[model samples]
Target: FRQIVVEFLRPPTHSDEQIRSMKAKANFPTDIGRRLRFENAFCRAWDLNLPPQQQHDVRQHILSYMLVFTTASRMRGIHPDGAPGLFDHTYEDNQVVWKPAPEDAAGMPAQAYGMQNGSADRAMGCLLV
Candidate 1:
């Protein structure tokens, strides 16, 4: 599962034109289309011999992994200054600095897809089950 996730996140060898074509045909963003492709590949490779229950469980695990991966990626985009260490602690006059506002901290990942109010957490909860 970890190997699958790593492979999915690996840089695609497709040229820019090929990627644009894929995104256009999928009628969605490139990242989303790529995720769907990876999901299908995972299903093909692993779902063939598994019992139904195990298949569902493995699928959920992969979904949860993808959610966390993409959420972290979005957060990094929104807070590039924290890219080196998202939770890095710094003190200024004995007070912690660099804290993100609640909305800023929670909103970016959710808002990336027009979701609101910590929907990322709800999505992860569902996927983890």
Candidate 2:
């Protein structure tokens, strides 16, 4: 018999609060609600969990430091084993300064993983990005 691959997408249709209430009723309350934040695609991308006016402000404040932290970690020679890939950066542009690497130095994809049959449908939810 041949293996069958069936792909599906579950839209974020239930609010975290709703999920939490359901879980608590089932005696399986969890912290997953804290991470997922919002339930819908439009809200998630816009980070609408925050007040409308504060969303842009919050995102700008945190995003500025991401590049600086990554560049500093690289310069300090603190790379985790085979990590940060082979790319470098030039803070002048705040972008990854890509360059060619030796063939053997190229990074390889990590092991593949998938949700078990029961929850695969939910976990396979699609996102535009």
Q: Find the candidate with the highest TM-score and give its number.
A: 1
Q: How far is candidate 1 from the true structure (C-alpha RMSD, Å)?
A: 17.8
In model 2, which runs have C-alpha deviations exceeding 4 angstroms?
1-10, 28-129
In the predicted model 1, the residue pairs found to clash are none
Best by lDDT: 1
Compose the digit string of candidate 2's lDDT tens values, residues 1-129: 222222227644446675444444331222211134233332331111111111111011110011111111112111223232233322331233322322222122211111111221221111110
Which pairs clash in model 2?
Answer: none
**Decoy 2 TM-score against native:** 0.17
Q: Give the Cα-based TM-score of candidate 1 against the true structure.
A: 0.20
Local distance difference test values of all predictions, in order: 0.23, 0.22
Error of 1 at 30 (Å): 4.9
